[model samples]
Structure formats: structure tokens, C-alpha cells
Target: MNPFSVFLRARYGKCFASREAIARHQQQAFAHLRRHIMPRSPFYKDFADQPYENWPMMNKALMMEHFTDINTAGITKEDALDIALTSEEKRDFAPMIGQVAVGLSTGTSGQRGLFASNKRERALWAALMLGRFSPSFLRSQRVCLFLRANNMLYERLGNALISFEFYDLLQAFDLHLPRLNKQNPTVLIAPAQILRLLAHAQNDGAIDIQPRCIISVAEVLSPEDEVAITDVFGVEVDQVYQCTEGVLGMTCRAGSLHLNEAYVHIERDIIDEASGAFAPIITDLTRETQPVLKYRLDDILIPDDEPCPCGCASLRLKRIEGRCDDILYWQKHDGGLQMIPSDLIRQAVATSQCEIRDYRAVQVGQHLLKIWLDTDDFALACQYVEQNLLMEAAKLNTQLPELNFHQGITSHLDQKRRRVIAK
Candidate 1:
């Protein structure tokens, strides 16, 4: 192991790993964030003058509206997107912009955000990931990292024992499924949606290969999806909840989501059950290029109350709820908007013991609700759900709206299957 990685392992694992350690690390990391980026970065400097206690929170809309002023010191949003989108053609995509790497998201919520990382930042991420997910892989194991676009940070993991291969899911599954199965990858990291499809393929006798373990990323791994993926792969289906916003948290070996306490600080907004859903207020402590200080995220995160089996002291995140965009809009008696938590609805439906493997709720009109499930028992299950929803909706003080239950709601082109859809 390198000297820096050893130091990081001790500093992050031994020293700043528990709740007490996390507090101390955050204080030091926040101090360094202010000291290092505040002076040179214009985006951070503008907000640096604000009181630390009362620092303004930012969101994606604000970042998009003020793209130029909010970006990192030497990069622009347009330049970063152009470079990221064009990176597919380059052999060394990450080094195209020197030691810095630019990445863009699919922007499922309308506008994509830009993420930049220098060599040191990339190494820190790599080390943390390696330490948590595959300590064995670092010595000798083949790792397959599935991504939409290739970058140096992702590609640099290629080694003799740890042979890294990046495959784009955009390609035909038939083409790559065989290749991936042939490679016999030791560690398979991918989005949960893709994993679920692969699981389905295996059940249907299309693909016949097993991975040691599966690490899910990008989207929320639903309870049903988790079961299917885990069963098909014959391994534990863990999740890593991260994005362009920041490396918010990752699932530990014990199957609990532990925030990356050494690199980021988080403050969450808890929505009253009577209101709708809680959103996250994020602060990226390690972002030097485009410092995201007190940025609000659209995605939802559950509270950490259950004590984890894992001994890590970092704050726990139970589950990443749906995004703000996924919230269903409804009319109140006062003629205003009231939102419904899609995650809550999914939980209600999943708890029914109705054999509902997959489902989607689509709002056709103010008074219409379409519920689609992937089971033969959906009709009988929906009958019970219809009554349960009426009682549940009454608690929320909204009409149950017409309920139409259907079977087999096909997956979208993006491969994302939404449980609730509001028009």
C-alpha cells in the first residue's frame, strides 16, 4: 500500500471514524474548506462572507441559473459538459483536462450538474471505495465498474489482480451481457435498475453467471428490486448513494449506509409526516474546484435511528427516498397544492403481502390514479390496497381519487421504474 493510503486508512478508519471522530474531523475539514477554497474560488468566496451559522443554502435551480458564477475557479459549466459528453471518443478521457476530471449526470430532474475532481480528490475517493467495498480487490481481484462514460478516475483501477473494465449500459444488453459473463468479474458495481434487469434475464434463462457481490449505485434500490437482484446474483445486493452533488454516503459491509464523514458534512430537513417528505441539506467538504457549501439536494433521505450492526461511527442513513420530482401533487380543500410522499406510498403497497413484485402509480387527472403491478395476484391485491389507501388518504386528509389497477407496467427507456407518477 502507498504511504498516503496508509495514512488515510488510519486517519479515516481509526482516528476519524466514529461519531466523536466524525465531529472532530468535520470541524477540521470545514476549517480547511474555508481556508483553502474561500480565498481562490470565486463561487465560494462570494458566499464565504456570510456567517457560518447562517450560511445560505443552495439548490440545483440556483446552480443552473447562476452557472457561470457558481462554478469552480477555472472551469465553466458549458465547458465541463462539452468535455464530459465528448469524452467517449478519447482513449484517455480523464487526462484530457490535465489531472482534473469532469463528469455530468443524466439530469433525471431536468438539468444536469457538473462534477470535477483533481488527481488527489480522485485518489481519495478510490481509496475510500476500495477500503469499504473490496479490501481484497486491492490485493488481487477483478473489478467491473459499469458507467455511462469512461474517465481516468474510473479507469485508473485497472491492475493485474484488480483488472478494471468499464462497460456502458447504453449498449445492447445482449452484446455486453455475454462479455460480462465471460469475464467472470469478481466485484460487479452498477445501477440497481440495470441489476434488476439482469436478474430478470437470469430468471428467464437468458444469462447464467454469478458475481461474488453486487454494489448498487445511482438510483434508489427499492425493496423488491433488492430481493430480486440478490436472489439472482446469489450475493448481497448493497447500495452506494452518491451523485454529482457529493459523495453523500455508502453502504458498509454490515448493510448500513454510513456517510463519508471525513469528506462531507450533512444537515437534513425532516418533513412532518403530516406534510410530505424530508430533503437533504448537503455540504461538500472536499470539493475544491466547485465548492458546494450548504447545497440543498432534491433527493430524499431517511433518518438514522436504528443502531447499525456495523461499528462505524458515521451518521446512518436508512434509505434514500425518492426525489422531489417524484412527489405526487394533489389539490387541498383550500385550493392549493399538497404533495404525497412516493416512498411512503411504495412502503404501504409493499407491506400488503400481496405478492406485488413490481408496481407503478400514474396520475392521469386530479381524480384518477393508475396502479400497475407485475403479478397475477395484482387484481386481488389491488382490491385490498384500494381500501387501505382510502384509510391512509383520509389520515392525510385527501380524497382517495379513483384507483385503476393494471398488470405489467413496462420499464421506461431510461430503465427507471417509478412507483408513483404525477402529471
Candidate 2:
């Protein structure tokens, strides 16, 4: 990355005069991408002069199939995968292919995503993350991150001003408590599940530490969990909506989840107009090693049209409503299919008027919804949750799915939590 680009982005990336200004900035960035970056890649060189929309839509499997061609770096997919797998197995993610670091995404089932990030990309990422979320530039800050796997890109974040530490999620999570307490980090970044565990630990007086910022990443953070964490920590939990694709979005100072429009251009694949829910097709301006243009992710996002009080001209999200495949469809009175967001199911369980610890809902059949609830009163929780879901179905004028309730939590700590599932 250019020194000037890194400096300006880290300083005033989030500040936008207006929405139109954001668009104009994106236009210039995309043009630069086409002119300077695309020609280097054999795959994209052909499309350098074409409109961005004319480019082929990319997904995990397709990206992997053409990985050797898609990446600007001369590294082959087989070589990259070997490095990533070795890193994962040895639990040491410091190795890389030259200056480019390779990481794998444990995407849906058998389809895995291979991502390559150069030194510049890593530095740019550090700049953006520290710019918006870091407590202070002058003060030496310790940052703790928990993840299933580590990568060289993450290791690059460590420097004189920032003490970066990665807690391996594959290891026993309980073992991390002592280190966490000792570090007393200024920033805590982890999946929502790990953050919840820490929150519980804090609430139970098992551990004592108060970080300046708590960031939820990888997994979707429910509204209920967010409030519960805020109440326990006495600080609002921030969220960084990211995946192997890139750092797509993060929570603004006002605590609203806004797209990283300063660095990435996102095109909406509208799923539902009524709720403004859409899947994102991203074209990251900063990515040069592996260009992620018009790459559509399976995640479904509900966008907030109302401008945030912080006045960020970037797009704001109401919530991430799980994956597109996780979305359940019900039969309407008119015999049409009605799409139901995962949030509606989550809300039904959250507001069931019963004290609940954890829950998971899966659609086993067209009209069969399998649910698991962890609560003191299983019967009452089931009855209220079923009633709430039925009421919501009635409001939608759609047929209600049969609720089959079980009595325990189905999620494991090490794995990414998927509270809502559709099959």
C-alpha cells in the first residue's frame, strides 16, 4: 500500500460529507483498481476495461477452482493450501508464501475458501482497525484475539504501540482466562460465543478484567446477547462483521454497524424488500493479491436506511440475519412462499418471557421446526416460545411450523455457533 493511502485512511476513513461523496470516492477507488491492480492478474486483465458488473460473480467454490488464476501473486492454490493446512495443523500461522500470507475459511460443509494477503494488505488492515476502534494512538495498548486459526496477516498487527496476542480457539478455552487476566487488554476481539463465555465468567466473578472495547467477530451477535454483554461489562460490545473475504464492516463510534465503504464497495443482492434485507456482493478496493470483486457471500444482512446519529455516510446495518441458506420459508394464505428471517425466530425465543441460557432452532421439514432450549423451566419456555412463534406466523398470515422442543443446548464452544438452521 502507498504510505499516503494508509495515512489518510487510518485518519479520516470513516468521515464522509454526504452519501454522494461516498459514492464519488468509491468510483475513483474502483477506477484505480481497474487501472492499476486488475492488469496484473491474468484472470482480471481481460476485464480491466469492462464495467465491474460485467465481471463474473464469484463464490467460495468458484474462487477456489480458479484460485491460481484469480490471485495476482504467482502462488498456486496447491502451494497456498499446503501452507495454510500446515499452519492450522502445527498451530503456528507464521509461515507464508513469500510476502503473501495464505489462510483458509471453513466455509459451508466441504467448500473451503483460500485467501492470500500481502504485507501491504495486512498493514492496511491494521491501520483501519486501529484507526476506528483502538482506545488511543499514544497509549501502549494490548490487544487480545481469539480465533479457530491464526495467520501471518494477523501476526503483522503486532508492533511497538500495539501488543497483539492470538488465543487459539482450538485449545482449551478455560486455559485462556489466566493469560487474559494477566494481559488486561485494551481491546478484546473474538467470536460472539467466546465473548459470551467471557461475559459469563465476568458475571460469575470467575475472572476480573475490563477491556476498553469488546469486538464480536466471525459469528453473528444477537440483539439479546449484545444487551446482556453490555449489562455485564458496563460497556457496549462492538462488532466487526468480517469473514475470509476481508474486513467488510465494523461498529462505528456511535455503536452502529456500518459497511467499510471507505475501503470496499458493496452491491446489494436484495433478498427481501419489506425488511430491506440483502446479501452483499463485495469488491474490495484494497485487495491486490487476491482480488475480491463482485464476490457474493451467503450471509444475509438487514440494512438500516435511516442515517445514524454519528452522521457516517456509509451504509448501516440493522443486523446480520444469519446465512441465506438458513432463511426459512413458510406457506402464506395465498399459497405463496413467505421468507422468514432468522431474527424473527431468535426474537421469539429471546422474548419468550422465560429465563433462558441458550437455544438453537433448525428447520427439519417444511412445517417442522426443531428447537433446543436451555432453561430452568423447559415446559414453560417451550409453551411460551411456541406461542410467540405461532403469533408471529399469524401476523404474517402464514402457516406455522410445528415446534418440536428439546431440553438442552446443542451448540459446542469450539465450533461457530449457528443458532438458526434451515434444511
For each candidate, give its TM-score against the true structure.
Answer: 0.85, 0.96
The reply for model 1, stretches above 4 Å from the true place, is 1-12, 15-20, 65-73, 88-95, 135-139, 273-277, 329-340, 351-354, 364-366, 394-398, 413-416
Model 1 Cα lDDT, one tens digit per residue, 126-196: 66666666636335766777765556667775557667777776566667777777777777888787888
Q: Model 2 over residues 1-423: C-alpha lDDT tens digits?
A: 463566566566547859899899899998999998999988889999997768999988889999999999988989999988888888888868888889987854447789998888888777777776887878998999998778877875787889898898888878999999999888999999888889999888878988888889989998878888888888889899988888899888788999988888999999988998899999998899999989989999999989999888889999888888888999899998899988888888888888988899989768899999999999999999989999999999999988789999855666778888898
Poorly placed runs, candidate 2 (over 4 Å): 1-14, 108-110
lDDT of 1: 0.70
Model 1 scores worst on lDDT over the 10 consecutive residues at 1-10
Candidate 1 at residue 283, lDDT?
83
lDDT of 2 at 273: 85
Determine the C-alpha RMSD for candidate 2 after optimal superposition of all C-alphas.
Answer: 1.5
lDDT of 2: 0.87
Candidate 1 shows a clash count of: 0
